[model samples]
Target chain A: MTALIDIKDVSHTFATDGGPLHVLDHLNISIEEGGFTAVVGPSGCGKSTLTRLVSGLMKPDEGEVWLHGERVKGPRSTVGMAFQNPVLLEWRTILDNVILPLEIVPNKLSRAERVDRAEFLLGLVGLTGFEDKKPSELSGGMRQRASLCRALVHKPEVLILDEPFGALDAFTREDLWQTMHKVKSEEPFTGLLITHDLRESIFLADQVVVMSGRPAHAQYIMDVPSTGERVIDDLYTPDSAERLNILRHQIQIAQGREPADVEAAQ
Target chain B: MSLKKIAIPTIAVIIFLLLWELLVWANGWPNFVMASPSDLGPAYVRYWDLFLINGWQTLWRTVAGLALAIVFGTALGMIMGFSKVMRDALYPLLVGFNAIPKATVVPIIALMFVGAHDFNTVLIAFMISFFPIAVSVSIGLSTLEPEYRDILRSLGASKMTIFWKIALPKTLPEFFGALKVAVTLAFIGTNLMEIVSPHGRGLGALFDSGRTNSDYPLMFAVLIALAFLGIVLYYVVVVLEKIFAGWAERQET
Candidate 1:
């Protein structure tokens, strides 16, 4: 498969009162077309920064980020993003929030067509009847689902998720993972998800990229078997546990803790 | 359904007014010194047409000044909010202008446009009402969520598109809030102008004439008219606010 996104030796640093703080250090990554990739790391490991760079919200201090053979200079409309916080506009109803991108992109579709598209996306996310409710009226999981609908409404080539389900409970998070998987199956697109949840990464991704601590660079790339269906039972298998252990170990080592000791503590 | 809530305030006002009328009548005060409600009622009815005519003049000036202020102040405020360079350049000047009491400049305005005929009064009204709107709008636009800004940026929205779609809509509530205050200031400013330069007939001119000739009843009538006009204009803004900002209000509640 051809690369949909290419990050070549990208590094980022921010100036601080004490000194320069390095975030990403010469990170090289490439995402294949129609692939689902998850990036996992401990907190402050620059995982979110990686998504921001791919989405063209921030430029790498050194090196290049290319999307579909073009250098990423600024925000790219072809990319859609959802955050951990859901970030829905409070004043807008769920339907309006889902259709927000279309409102900004005038003449993209007729008014009737836009409404149909918004309804279709809302239905896909199981938010059909809650369309007219404001964000404040919805649960955290529902809000994030609405946000997901919003991100997909524009039908962008690449979807960037920055821990979109991090704020939800375990049951809700599992349910949304399946919902996301179902949505992915219906509308296949290149996805880059930055998350700390190893099970989420293993279950949803075609490939999982692990990163080291701050001044983070790609540390390991693990390919998840293309199993057609994943259930909670699959998580009990020795292979699944091994994969999870590897990721857990990598995170511990990156955070300056001895992996053996961390594992013992756990 | 909530008759008790409504009745308590109504009863209090009636009792207060009755006591005032009794006190004025019992003391045998001069009519010019303090006109009772009974005395003022007939006076108000007799001069209702004149009061309305003057009230209309004041109302027109206040509304016109407010409209002009909304246009200029909202635009300037949005610019200041969106651009640091604009804020740095224009903010201090705005502060300096605001620092000078608008009332103190009425004489200067009158002297400058003595024969200009109603021009100075409208200008003074605009000056006084404009600042609050500009300040409120700037604050509102500047305080938008970073996430929303990010969304716009990622969508490749142009600066003008961002302003019109995001900034302008977000500032509507604050703009209306400032407008509520500006309406009252517009009334005060227009009245001040009329007092300083009484060319055309307005509430302020009526007030000045009544005070000069000791027409206490007429003075009371103008005050009543001013109160009614101010209340009416304020409610108009409130209604518009409810219509325009219904979505935001729903979110708040």
Candidate 2:
């Protein structure tokens, strides 16, 4: 099947104070129509550069990025993006913040329907009473949850989570993974997550694509074993543990910090 | 909101007033030489008409000049902040203009306007007091987080949309801060022009006369009136800050 999103033989260079920085070289990645794919890589591997390319915020110097069979040249309207920081507008109330996309992008829904959708999405994430609250009024995790609702409110064809849970506390992170899956099951959009955490990739992604160091490329690919519907308890299984372990070792080697590095440090 | 806010300043002013009264009394200085705090009342009654007319003139001039400054300053700031070329071209000019000693610039302004004293005064005020506000508003627009723009862009927001929804709303707190500062500078600009101009008719003129005649009560009285005007205008900006900038404050402060 033709992929919904495709990055084929893409290379990008950034000019910095030091010199030309070649961050991604001849990288290839693609996602099926409704797949949730996670990209895990070492720091400075140009993961964010990859995101910018896919989102059409920046064009790759070589090759091309195609979305739904069309080349992406500018910011795409049919995509939702969230970063590590919630990036909520402090001046706007929670409901206003969640519905901010609707305020900008052209929509066919009535104003009331827009508000209702925003309210319903907020409710889906257990934020029923925070409709009038400002982004600042919410806690960090709650703010991220609101951000998640915002990304989904317009019901885009794709959702990009660039380490969306990286900064949250461990418990909050774990809780949000469950929230992530729950939301995904209900709202089945293609998702692309860029993360450093191997377990997070294993838990949340249908397919995990790994990248090597700067001038990055797809170095490895792994699939989570088929489960009819994933639950929090399924994460406790030994098979999942094995997957996690192998993924960890793969990442360590790609990062050039293998068991030998650990032994030498010891 | 706290005893420190209201009580400390009041107590300090009272203490300063008492000390001034004691000094005048201790030296047995004449009212022309030095006036006691109590002398302000009768002296005010003596020049109440002059006070009202001149104070009104000064107050209105200050407001008019400041209002014009705000409009021009905000626009300039938004432009400079958004465009690197404009900023690079104008920033140095602005920095130089701001440094040129507005006190000296007033005479040249008076010369340019020739007979239009009021225009000259207002122009002086606008020129002197607009930098902080312009710099403030533009900085606010320019310094927005990269992610904020990216999120908006991903939603297919145009450059104008990002500006209207993000840049403008984000500048409120900084804009208000600049207004508060500009109000005080407005007073300075107006009064300085008034001081040097021969046809001085404002409290600044009264100050010039009091200085010439060494009329201590008259100088103190004009200062009191100017202080009242300054407080009122400053508070107007503060109230505006609360109304318009409350969201920004609640967001971060």
Candidate 3:
């Protein structure tokens, strides 16, 4: 079967006041249906830009993005997005905010059905009773949970998480990582996560793609050895440490702190 | 609002009136030159009928002009917000027009549509007031967080959908803030036309008549009436803002 998302040698350049700034250079990545992939790179390696490309929010200057073997010319309702800031509308109750995507996307579901859908997701995220509360009433973690439900409420084909848990504290972040696993098992969707935390990548994703510095491409791709269901304690295993070390070394090479030969010698 | 909030301003106004009465008494200024707060009381009772008729005229004209400003300003603002080309084209012209003293244009408007006093008064109010609303609304639209927009766009939302679902609500706080200011400007605009193009209507015309007869107490009474109307209108906006955009306000709880 064709990959659910196929980015074909995408290249992009942004015009700045100083002149043209190259961001992505001949980058290629693909995610199979129901697969989760995490992208980790330097601060400005155009990882966020990659999410925009897959979602079709913006077109790559050179390459074509294909979804289910079709070129993405513009944004698709099949794609759902979540960011670090949940950005729930203050005017809306948590339930209403979660239902926002359903309102925007074309749907046959009645209002009652829509509420049922959002309520289910919110329950999965442990936000059961806070549906009537405003966004400000919830803690940061709770708000992000509502944001995740909003993304999934429409049962999107692809869910783009642009550092969705980046702003949370360590404990909350880990809790969310497990919640992510639970959410995916309940609502299967192709997931593309853009993150900076290395531990987060191995914990949540079956595959991690390390990207090089600016004008980045996928420098190294690692298949996380599946050990059935994942838990936070699983990250402490000796096997998981070795994998983390390898990925860390690769990132050093990508960052130009260590020569590529240093890894080859080891 | 708390009772303390209302009581504080009320007490301050009473103190202010007492000081004014004391000043008039000490100075022993002629009644024709300066009227004390006590003098204003009798003047109000004497001209109570005239105040009702003229005050109603000014009140309606101000409300009508502000209503027009809100409609026209919101449309213009949405256009400027959505299109960069239109914003660039219209902004400079709007700024220039707004800069022209509205008082100077009152007579020109009066001359252009001779005897259309009500229209001229309403137009001046709209002209003076709409700029802030348009400018505030455009600012609100332009500064929208890109992440919120991207969330919608990825869902294949149209521009209109994004505007209604996201942009319009986000712009409410700014819109209401601009409305508060524009209401005051609308009052000033109506009064300007009434005073300059006096056509036997509004408190402004009454004030002018008091000046002609050298009835200082009557002039002060009219001034007090204008201030009262402005306050009532301003509080109406504040109450409406509380009802509509209450979420924008920071809650103590």
RMSD each, Å: 3.2, 2.3, 2.4
lDDT of 3: 0.93
Find the candidate with the highest lDDT and give its number: 3
Model 1 regions more than 4 Å off: A15-20, A105-108, A258-266, B1-36, B251-253
TM-score of 2: 0.95
Q: Residue B185 CA error for candidate 3 (Å)?
A: 0.6
Q: Across residues B132-179, which tens digit of lDDT does each residue of candidate 1 receive?
A: 999999999889876777777788888888777677778889999999
Cα lDDT tens digits, model 2, A1-266, are 67999999998899999999998989999998888899998899999988888888899999999999999999878899999999998888999899999988898988899999999889888899999998878888999999999999989899999999999998899889988888988888898999988878888888999998788888888988646357677778898898887777777877888767866887
Question: How high is the DockQ of candidate 3?
Answer: 0.81
lDDT tens readout by residue for model 3, A79-142: 8899999989999999999999988888899999989999999999999999999998889999
TM-score (chain A only) for the predictions, listed in order: 0.96, 0.95, 0.96
Instruction: Judge candidate 2 against the unseen true structure and give its global Cα lDDT, from 0 to 1.
Output: 0.88
What fraction of the true interface does each of the listed models get right, in terms of native contacts kept? 0.63, 0.91, 0.95
lDDT of each: 0.86, 0.88, 0.93
**lDDT tens readout by residue for model 2, B138-243:** 8998898999999999878999999999888888899999898999999999898889884668899988888898778888888888888999999889888888
**Docking band of candidate 3:** high
- For all candidates, the clash counts are 0, 0, 0
